[model samples]
Target chain A: MNDQRPRILLADDEKAITSNLAPFLERGGFSVTVAADGQAALDGIAALHPDLVILDVLMPRLDGREVLRRLRRAGNWIPVILLTQVGEAAERALALEEGADDYLNKPFDPSELVARIRSVLRRVTPGQPPLASAWQLACPPEAPGQPALALDRRSRRVSLDGRTLDLTPKAVALLEYMLTHPGELLSRERLLDAVWGWDYPAGTRTVDTRMAELRRALGDDPARPRFIETLPGEGYRFVARVVAA
Target chain B: MKITWRDLLLAALPAALAGVAATVLRLSLGRLAVLLLRADIGTALVLLGSSLSLFLLVYLGARRAGIARSRAAIERHDRESGEARRRFIHRLDHELKNPLTALRAALANLQLALSESDRAQRVGDVRLQAERIGRLVADLRKLSELEERPIEQLPVDLPGLLEEVVEAARSNPAYAGRELRLVVSQVPWKLPPAVGDRDLLALAFYNLVENALKFTKAHDPVEVRASEDGRALIVEVADRGPGIPAEDQPRIFEELYRGANARGFEGSGLGLSLVRMIVARHAGSVSVRSRPGQGTVFTVRLPFDARDRAPVPAAG
Candidate 1:
């Protein structure tokens, strides 16, 4: 079961699909392991240590996204390609930005998938580019009051003036939303809905907790805030001139 | 059916009260005419005049209530059907796109084929996927036509139809080693013949049984049972397979809408929806009941044509 070909864990619920894709990938010189569901995909990744894994978003038991999120949260940097059903550009970019190597829309040619897999495996090889499947997101400080910050969406690495800063996924999501909607008067309730979702167990406390961590990670003093400005009765606001990254 | 009961209550209760009120008003007016003014001949005329007016009042009130109830039902039906149409269009893309993708992959393989046999195999793969897309388009057309085509109002033997569909299901390759049971029982009477186009009815029943076979495991028994409740012949195809999720169950019969749990199985997502349109054309309704991890049973009730009340001769 082990060989020189790039090992791929192909996770899709469709039997017809796995039968077709498995042979195509094998012919292209990659060892393929077909996982019928999301749980099997995770277990396959652990046991096989495949070079790359292709995940379908809609599967039984666990979806591809939960699998991707869990893997990233556990700090596993294995290159992953997501097979997304959505054709929207922004959603595809978001999937790529979700710490995945790349995204291919469903019903795509197998060769296109093979090309993506080969490219991803090459990037993860030693002596290649530093961030594998990474997208560099920099906020341009075009105006005098604009903030100078850069955040890597794929890697979740925040940088202030060329200095890299570490942040959790939650804090990154909070900062990402605020950065995109600069100067908007965002209430705590609004932030919670946008970032943590209404179904999230924690109350407004999670918002304050993540904000505190964001400020700490960025080394910003709440008393004299540089980016996140908190009002006494109101909510937090990004006090910087910004443009869409 | 529940709505029908509610509507009946809405109309009947109000009409009954109006009838009592009309009686009281007639007696009061007759007494007032005779006692208050001492006019007997005029009292008879007054009573005669108020009867028609009171009848009109009650008739108009009941009619209005019926109209209101019908309006609400139509609004709800339109809303839900519109939603189903929207989902059908949404899923239409994925259903076509996946097969086309595979077809393209096969074509790509054909170009890379090294030997004659390899080339032939690739060509076969291409044909298979292309045929799949063709079948999907054909099924869609058949369903749309079924919607427009006038159904033949001929007597359809309910028990005979079930046996035909069940036998056909037994012969299917997928039904190998699987048990499909068909039971027809009409308490105190033989099964009544349903009224519809006979071929279409058969297709609908066959699709239901096929769906059961598709979802259940190879060894699971798929049962088709037909019974009559005086007004309709109720046929159910029950399978001991993975039950549909509560959310997906409602939309499963919508054209091209596949359940999340059923994505692993290859399908055009047209079978159940086609069954829906067919049964609907025959003046019948279909419903599903399922519990996740336990099993699912699809029930189709075809109302026996009211005019055709005679039960079919019992079959051995």
Candidate 2:
């Protein structure tokens, strides 16, 4: 309570996230206090007056939004960052509009969290400032070398390993459909209806041609394929890992 | 809608006219009988025949009018719901697009990230969004598959399946990964085995319980109960979290339907729809009853064969 380190109140009901994150934040040069739920978080904020608060959006009894509402309603200009679990845009916008200085998604890198906290603190207090959990829990953020394949839907471009590959409209459509619906056994009918219009004058073979062209562009081998797999007599499956950009 | 006295009088005027006409006819018939047959019995017979025919005509006409009114109501309801269905299509795209847009930005940031940690951080961002997209795609598939194919039928122990569903939900990594305990109401019973794909039924129950967990605190009782109701098996999952608003209750089971409160929470919006579809596939029904602040309860009724009435599999 008397030390120089900025105090941070990290409130989340999830023990796994809080357990690993609290230690990481403390090690990163902040005195971390934890609250199990939103109501407890409100109590902690009033009693402790921590430098900053990192709130989780979903909690028992009172949710993160409700806590933020009460805090802002009471004219407390405390800096807050929301750890939103859903990767939704309207929700992110709503979170910020509700007076959060900044927001981060869950299953995030701890270093990123540290960076966000630093930026939000500097902006809030001019020089010195506040607080936040996260990272090292929830199974270590999938595997490395992720997102090898990325698709830009706006430009209708498909990129592999950071390079945009030249693919026809049909190939793009087919790949886009496959990328979006991963691990699905897509029949020729499903592919045709999705990529091409239902009334398009083409048969299932049209789907096969698009598949081959897309495969050729992706440089995926038909045998032991890394990206897409052909399930004989059934349908085609997008077997590769796709991180949608 | 506010029925004035005038409207009521107007409604009664037709019946009143009919009564007056009958009375007049009966009197006239009586005079005719006195003039011709010279008997009061003749007057009574004519009145009885005429009144019986009038009553039959009124009954037939009223039934036809009632049916026409109901049919119009049903058609209006269908049109309104069709409009609602179209309204929901716009919601699904945002779910996938948001994650993908974030992923793209992160990948773009990776190029500019100077330090090794920053690059790692950006990649981590990309990975998380990709996984989020992965979950949405998988959920969509899960929903579509239920409609596109037939379900397998097999004898599934009711109590055992429910216990396993609660168990799996308790350990679900989505509940902040670990050490999160769900308080499920006691689920011990003797009942006939339900005949359906065991895995799907398990998924249905697990989704229900997980939804309950999402809205409620860790210590809140996610009440689970199972009982036999004549020819069906009834299972209920209830929660004491903020109950769904009345307006959102009807659309909650639709695909990609995120309620006002649900949007702030983490969910794909397909969980309940999947449960509904799974129940439908087995000729069962899933329904929700909730009051704001009081909580929500989902009841699933699966019809079982009458022959398997033996109370077996008392295992928990």
Candidate 3:
């Protein structure tokens, strides 16, 4: 069994908050790094290259927004979740638009943050296959006169109707998971954990975006989905009969 | 009594008009002069009486109108001020009661048989409540002093005072994540000394900065800028946060008048009122410009002491 754990960078200027939260996160199976201020947070991100970053919107020196802005500008797409105060809906919206993975208001239950972390990790981290045999069984040979979707696990590629789809690795991983599951009603959390990894803190909006991108690539409509069927608030379903090619 | 020429003219004008009317009637009826004169005289007398009555009526009406207008203005002012005083009292009671209740509850809880950690936490709560009460009382006292007491004017170093206030705010744990920056120009220009009590002015600046921090995000920078505008020193505290709503701006300086957006935030609402009071005492003015989404800028302008005319050089 692998002993590796996902690394989380927790940035807040409040010492009391970090001191209290870091241990809880560590107990939840994450290796946590604490940054005292915005500048420290940015420096930590550069040095640590952590799997996920939890940022407080208000921090001394650079602040969370500036840090996020710099990170995005530098093309660092590490999963980020913002910790904001209550009644900051406008700021929360701005954060999301600026590519923040998710946001949680302060005075939140620690358990809720842990749950979000798990869900986000699942969506962001590409889960490792257990065995080579399991990889081979991921997709089987295609049947005659059927529209088929094939996933080449080795190449991290997905092909539909013998035509290669230009998909990001994350998108391909998502497609592979949905195809493998077939008729199962996969919840967003399940998809997030299964495809992204166990500890990613990306929100359902992230899942929604990836789903939209995948649908566009597969030439599927959300209103009348051919392959990916959205269950609105519940989750998504792959209705297409995917055969092994 | 000494009558002026104007008063004599006013008295004679009616009689003159009556005489002129009588002459016209007598001339028109030349053959029947005596009978026409008698009738014309009677007509003139009636006309004079009516004209005098009308003049008196207009003069009295004009005086009454003037009195009524002033009376209405006085009554309106009294009503408004009375309502304002009532609101101030009501808010004071409410604000004071909150901490008092908390303190009582904490005291009661302290009598319970609890663990060491729980007892310590309860003690902390009690201390916090006590501190809140102290702050409320202190603010009320300061507000009254600012309103009633005469400010002891001195040549105050505007930049130094602001730096001290900002530094104090930066060190406060409550404002831990917020950035407090003093925005200065590349040219190190000297700022004229504002004529005010140093301690009171510092308190005003501190309150403004603290208020800014309360509204702004922890990461947002609260910039304090000071410049000389001729004879006045203009100090502005700007924040990048959700601004005061249009409707809230006018009444924000009123005692205990909180804004619509101030619901979730913790404040006594006495800060700005105190600032306004202090500035007014120093013969200065404070105003705010804010838009809903953009941000807020609170500008305080105080006159420089004419006695200290020499521009003091900026300390390196």
TM-score of chain A of each: 0.52, 0.49, 0.51
Whichever of 2 and 3 has more TM-score, that candidate is 3
lDDT of 1: 0.74
User: Which residue pairs of candidate 1 clash?
Assistant: A13-B264
Of all native A–B interface contacts, model 3 reproduces a fraction of 0.00
**What is the TM-score of candidate 1?**
0.44
B68-87 per-residue lDDT for model 2 (tens digits): 65566577678878876676
Which predicted model would earn the best lDDT? 1
Tens digits of per-residue lDDT, candidate 3, B93-142, equal 88888888988898888889389988998899998877677556656655
lDDT of 3 by residue, A1-245 (tens): 87589999999999998999999999999999999999999999889889889998889898897888788777677877777531122332354346555556554558768876775665453322212113322333245654556677556667767788887655776786676555657778667544432211223444776787798887787887767898878899877754433
Superposition TM-score, candidate 2 onto the true structure: 0.44
Give per-residue lDDT, candidate 3, residue A14.
Answer: 92
Instruction: Quote the lDDT for A92 in model 1.
Output: 31
**Candidate 1 Cα errors over 4 Å, as ranges:** A1-245, B1-84, B310-316
Over A63-169, each residue of candidate 2 has an lDDT whose tens digit, in order, gives 99899889887877688888853222233235434666655655456876776676566546422122111100011113575436666654566676667798765
- All candidates: TM-score: 0.44, 0.44, 0.45
